[model samples]
Target: MPKTLEGEIAADHAEHPTAANGAGATSVRHDRRTSVPRAAWLIGPALVAGVAYLDPGNVASNMTAGAQYGYLLVWVVVLGNVMAWLIQYLSAKLGIVTGRSLPEVLGGRIRSRWGRRAYWLQAELVAMATDLAEVIGGAVALNLLFGIPLIWGGLITGTVSIGLLVLQSRRGPRTFEFVIIGLLAIIAIGFTVGVFVAPPSPAGMLDGLVPRFADANSVLLAASILGATIMPHAIYAHSALSRDRFATRRGEQAGERGATGSGGAAPSGATGKIAWHGFGIRRGTDVAPELTPGTATAVPTDTLVRATKWDVTIAMAIAGTVNLCILLLAAVNLAGVEGTDSLEGAYAALGVALGPVIATLFAVGLLASGLASTSVGAYAGAEIMYGLLHVRVPLLLRRLVTLIPALAILALGFDPTTSLVLSQVVLSFGIPFALIPLVALTAKAGVLGRWKNHWATTAAGVAASVFLITLNGVLLWLVLTGA
Candidate 1:
């Protein structure tokens, strides 16, 4: 029989005696409460995960959409971001409540060995597709800025990502978060500055929000935009990031105990001690009171969840705004310009129209986006392998392996922008595999316990899933029939 939440808490506490005594936990909690700046420390994991949203695939897709369709697909970007906020919140909630990533949860639930392997196979492919976009984007940026060969540029991007991953592994998650967030800041400045220099027409922008498509090609760009924005890897990465960020550690319960008073009584509520278990929170006398690792005991489930919402909101706002700015910059300036649909062309045009400074900044932003996002993508891929396959591969080896496809694409002289847009389209097709399982799992009371999704949340997830699947279907039909 499966162990109950109470049993898990007892086992966890037994493994860490310091947690029960509250000896080491109090000072750690106090430091967290007193030392770090409130807003800066609290908002992180989402920002790291949000890097995936502003990846090279996003720039390629959005820029292509703007240059080709000229504000016609603004509704797609906005709608995808709206859906992304809800989806990301649920992913974070699952991690905080269950103390497991989406991949880890699915790994345990699938039951069949073959079935798990099959799921992992598709997820791994999706992750590879994500890497293809980021590495290529970075490579293209390097080529634009320094006149390097695409292959060498890809190799350099891959090398930098491995270094970033090393930083993540050695320095711990918080340090990694800080580093990625710094890159995110650079990405924001690089991508959005051009918009101020040449803003899209307000009337045209408003029209683009009406939810209509121009043609079959427009449908492809829409799918690519959605794919780039609401990424499968981001979904996988956020849950794990949340799990790692909020996992209860030794003496964490002491912080909560400290919060209630010296006597360690439950605060205000009539319930028993607040016990955090592996699966969910248990409030009663029956369960052993314990806290998990990584999170402070003083931070309760409600507080962490609230913080997560803010984290996700801020991250999404930044990602969404940058993505929109990328499109609008192109829409206002590059639309109808010959050869402006590609990243290289776009770079040249921006230089010609807006001066070399803006173009240089644009390349710099793309480079940052590629670097930060590829690191996060590699992280997600690692988590997916660990959670679903239950196998551990060195991050360096995984980075090398994933780099092959992107490097080959670059070496073969495939158009980087086209490859990026198509990679996102592949990511679009993979969305249902991640989204359906996440929505279904989070909706179950057995999974999240009291934190299960509300009816409306479930409905929204279902609607988003259906819309994305339908969009992919239309894209497939258009391609096959040459619509």
Candidate 2:
């Protein structure tokens, strides 16, 4: 077996015609240089994945934290976001270096079929919980905005998500990314504008930054916030997103080379070039070369990894800011307010204290969060199933199947905000299952070659894992003991 990722790539390349022909050596070298997009163009994947952080689950958790605890859990949101930056970067790096997602890697590694099925069960459950939160949140948003019934609103949300998934399947990843990013912009504006209108007291905000929890309930909320901020599905989705963005198709490369007449520049839609709005962001038509069935792309691993860092950083910054803004908006305006415990309650409270416009924006943002996140959650669920079981279910079928749980809850008349918060807690329980594996795999030199995590990186990953697992343990103890 090949020892490192590059060795594996080289071994895979040995079978290709270009690698076999000595005359094609120069062409291969030129293709490697031209096929790698500049760092700036590699920005969308992480941002799209980052939307998972700003989902309605996040809005509910953060809003509840600030309203109930009055900034006590602010530290949790910040810490979670900081950890998310590292976790997401590692995920993106793994995909950029290895050309496989976390699930794909794990699926191949685990020897037992039962073990893989068991793992898939947990991941599927987590994905369902995610869908539940997103759908319920969307339902609540629609009800707040237009007085639509929760059941009907849920049906609408699920239908719209199917449409979004169709957009992703039909239009290609770039167009899908552009649409998600546009929704992300709307989410940012909708959530953050309220904070500027009624800024939290600086002293209170700083005090809230201190690491302390009031009680067992506080710990639960903290866990919910962390779960919402550092999502398991986002981790799974980011790796896949990065792999899709960077993976090069050899047939496309050869076709582009032939069509360009050898010496002429590749056209706007050539293999390496990613065109947006009728213009190419990168020079070449293709992005990178394929390594193997499940391995790294031909782009220089270091360059892609570096670009992934920027991508993850920018993504985390936006997600973290929007999350903080949500908490702060509630902290300043809704703390001690009776009706602010739920999203609808919060919306009504915001209108009472601020104005109708601010409340409307909050509802709009929540709607965007729900719509965007449910779509991404569906995508992640599909990837998870494909990676673990190697089964390819139609996206629409999966979306409809997943929507049943959320719609059922809404139909049963469960509190939307409570469901959202509890769903995040379920997500928190799932964090270690995804996170520990990611950390362990990325630390392995065999998996990532020289791009494997350095000792420091591994140590940080270990620390994060320990912290999260410990928190979950504490939460379990508290809940069981009725603390």
Candidate 3:
């Protein structure tokens, strides 16, 4: 069965062309549903990889691990990136083929009632807990950069929810793209500047990339990196974003076209018979229509080609390089400090090793990462609500959900460094909760239609999932029993 919103939109459009069509015959709103061409799939990961780098939880994880172990933990980050790439590619393929996100596909299409409720509850908890980290981390960074009290910063960060909501409502999906790109640039520049001064040795850097098993923290930290990279939201966000680029029905056609020589239908005729699918936008509205329903009315091949794999791959590589640079910077500057357990300690040590100006820049980078990641987390939370409940939550309300924990964490007084570590732990703990369902959904041919995972892909995905689950389990056991 189609979702309530998809059904409602489809039925209403079928019933009332005039309502969907606008008062003036001069312009008409194309149906939002349509198949997308080959290029549209790139949009999601390109957008998400940027946001993932800037996420506050990720910063904390990278910063803390870097400070404590130096470049010794670089291997964990490398492995995490490789694993995340595999998972996200699998996730995007699932969406492109099946036309539904992981949660809904698992809940409504594939699972039993009990399974649906369990998955929903689990995903919701992960979303809520994840927001707390974003809010608190952003607030902490604000405190460091602006000299504002943590409590006030939390209040200010909480208020950011209103801004995010406004962006979502007025700017629509493009707002997400704009904010993520800007933050990614900010972080990239900061790392570049920082690394130029305190570069890691090539030998040490290579060593860092090798997996370490010398300590419990190393094992757990590796898990945290993987957990952070393969976030629950990335799975859903990738699917939703892909839909925005292409319609499910025409995805095969677009793929076949891209595979063959049909780069795009012979450019729109002089009569404009081949207009771009999901291309038109009137001023003042941010939400673009999905590509599938509208591809019938336009030239999707050209427009989608604009959102090519090269675009996404380049963006992911940049984000990955930037993330690696930040870890290298921390390893170089703060690795020797016995007490450098927190970002503040790392910042203070950076000021000594680099300079006050460099330290200030680090703060600026941290702040950018926090705010960017916070927006992604908040957006994921709102989208999950829309998909699960069939109604969108106001951005203002979602901000409150983020702010409450931020304010409490700041006001009640937790050690900022410790808090950062715990946030990474929380993210790690949540991974198995997200991954098991992802594996199950991908493996089932009936659920994914013709887009189901191939035997080799399923084997690889399941193997990865089980290895991660066991890794997470061992970490949990060690934490509990102090082994």
Segments of candidate 2 deviating more than 4 angstroms: 1-37, 248-295
lDDT of 3 by residue, 1-483 (tens): 223234434554465564333222112333344334223333544564446645666677777778778888787777666666656665555555454455545545534656555566666666766666667776777877877888787677666645654664555555556666777788778656889987788999987766666688877777766666667776666655554434333332232233232433321212211111111222321222222322321222223324434444665577667667777887887777866677777778888889988888877777776666776676556556555544445566657765676567778888865665566666666676666667677677665543456788777777777877788888888888897
- Can you give the lDDT of residue 466 in candidate 1? 98
Model 1, CA-based lDDT:
0.82
TM-scores of all predicted structures? 0.84, 0.85, 0.77
Off by over 4 Å in 3: 1-45, 110-114, 245-312, 443-450
Candidate 2 C-alpha lDDT tens digits along 1-483: 443334434543674556333223223432232123355555789999999999999999999999998878888989999999999999988877666678978988999999999999999999999999999999999999999999999999999998887777666677889999999999999999999888788898899889999988899999999999889999998988887766443333343344432433334444533222110122343333323322235544555676678889999999999999999999999999998889989999999998999999999999999999999998899889977887778666788899999999999988889999999999999999999999999998788866788999999999999999999999999999989
Local distance difference test, candidate 2:
0.82
Put down candidate 1 lDDT per residue, 142-161, tens digits, no spaces: 99999999999999999999
Highest TM-score: which candidate?
Answer: 2
RMSD of each: 8.7, 8.2, 9.9
Report how far off residue 377 is in candidate 1 (Å). Answer: 0.6
Least accurate stretch of 10 residues (summed lDDT) in model 1? 27-36
Alpha-carbon deviation at 415 in model 3, angstroms: 1.4
Q: In model 1, how large is the Cα lDDT of residue 230? A: 93
- Please give the TM-score that candidate 2 achieves against the real structure: 0.85
